[model samples]
Target: MSFKRVFKQFSGSTLPRFFGSDKEVDEFSQKYQYDPKEKLGEGQFAKVYKAYGKDDGLEYAVKVVDKRSLSNLDREGLKLEIQVLEEVDHPNIVKLHETFEMKGKIILVLELVKGGELFDRIVAKESYSERDAASVIQKVAAALKYCHERKIVHRDLKPENLLLVSETDDTSVKLADFGFAAFCHDELDDGCGTLVYVAPEILRGRKYRTSPDMWSLGVITYILLCGYPPFFDTDQEALSKKIIKGKYKFRQEDWQNISEDAKDFIRGLLKRDPEARMTAEDVLEHPWISNLAAVPDLPLSTMQKELREFLAKERMRKALGAVIAINRLRNTLNAFAFNDVDGDDDGDDDGEEGEEVREEDI
Candidate 1:
């Protein structure tokens, strides 16, 4: 894995065509069309290079994939990926400008986004501030919504898959790394998606749905606020167990300054049971995400007892319900211990005739 910082300041007067079907321009050689500049990044899938249109001077990201490197991969997988990309079109998703084969290597020309991988930013900065975190996730949510609407599930939605292509002006949170992307109607590979971020159902090798994408989003959200994955462990077996078990922690030290709504969002999406997890639409309507200003604070009452109560006993969520229930019950008096006769005045026990009372006292 590698990273690059792109600034989308296009000086081109004409609106750029997002996708071009014209792969063969016999009038222009492949190298004549795009001037490949600096190497943007390298990955198992392909090497990203900064390219500029020789005649148009427009910037682009060209992914170079040498067939020799991927000896194990087949042509059908490539076709599926291209088909998936063609079917998906969203602002947050990396735009496929063009594709062409040359020199026994396939090239994917895309919009050059330079913000680097989102995970890199979080790790480099230790953690994302509340506003920054909000901005990042909003773009992700938009991308996922677009994919889900088209019946395309990005099976692998790790942070590295998210790219930032700008620093100041042409800013965007574009989704990249679509090698594992597949259609919901397609047969799934048991070992698909990243292990650390894969949903529990996928780990169990079961037939699942789009919930895994939500699970990955939850993991990304957790990492954004807390600086690391929620259920991560070093040992492969242990990590696998934790992921399959869907165990998570909301340590105050780790989650300080983060909003209650944010936590709630993570908890619901990361639930062990796929059915219990929130859908893409539900996430869009969630308080924290829907209202940018609705992020919770500690001093305020929102993250206080009511919020805690909501968490503890909220009908639809299971994240911090246990702790909230305990805290909520603390305010409770536990009246189960009180005898009803002590407070009853409708009819006194002494007023009851034939009541067997004086037998056992010695």
Candidate 2:
């Protein structure tokens, strides 16, 4: 697959009239006032702005997608994101208030999360601990459990994607960015995710499903406790090799004060064999999360410093060229075939089916 296809970054030739009939653009204009100057974030094909409801006067994040810039594949991916966002309803998940199909663009009205990303929030904390980390992971795992029960895989899970709903509410976590999410009706073939958090199965070009997401969560959980990724390398090849080998350690310097339960939790999720990996339900019931009250409150001062340094490097890397890295990895993988003899078992127990709720109800 091409880099754009694998990265799902919406880089391709323009496509006109992809949304069929245009819904009245005034539907959004009449209800919300969006100022382009109040831009919150931007991606390859979309820009999000801080908006205000005309009557309710509530703040919102309005994501504007330039449909004319998307290819057919990009359009399909956007539709899938919208569908998944519409179907999910959970306290820890970001809310989509409504959608508008304009003449040349599509707009999504989403809940405006005032708090920053996960690591940043923790770094600002006066005292960080395993208890605090568990609290954050519990929220993420709860959201994932809800999604997995519905056969929806987030595909991408990382510190940047985890958001705090309020600037003052540390516990108000929300899982944001469904751009790479999909319903796992069968084994998923696409290997679309950031380089660091991607599962080994995806890097090997193997068919996978929810277990990949669990692996991602495992990586995130490791970073949460230690303030650095379990696997790290500046070179893409070296990094992928480390991940594929599934060999990471809890270094003595950083892990000396950490609890065994937390380490065990990470091991369970980071298993190389998908069948041996822990499910989202298992995450919820793990002693680290289940017995959170008993978790040590020893301050992770060194961890906070490491987190700050990690965040700085992350920003620099993004500015320099995350897209370039993806292209390089894609080119490297094109020459090889990583077919496994094992059958296509997703290695997750299906949870009870939940009722599908519309955005309005959520």
Q: TM-score per candidate, in order?
A: 0.70, 0.86
After TM-score superposition, what is the CA distance of residue 98 in candidate 1 from its true location, in Å?
Answer: 1.0
Q: What residue pairs are clashing in model 1? A: 6-114, 113-165, 114-165, 115-164, 115-165
Which lDDT tens digits does candidate 2 get at residues 245-326? 6667776788899998988888888776787899999999999999989999899998898878887877887898854443
Prediction 1 global C-alpha lDDT: 0.60
Name the top TM-score candidate: 2
C-alpha lDDT score of every prediction, in listed order: 0.60, 0.79
As a TM-score, model 1 comes out at 0.70
Model 1, 204-233: lDDT tens digits are 555675778988988777766655566644
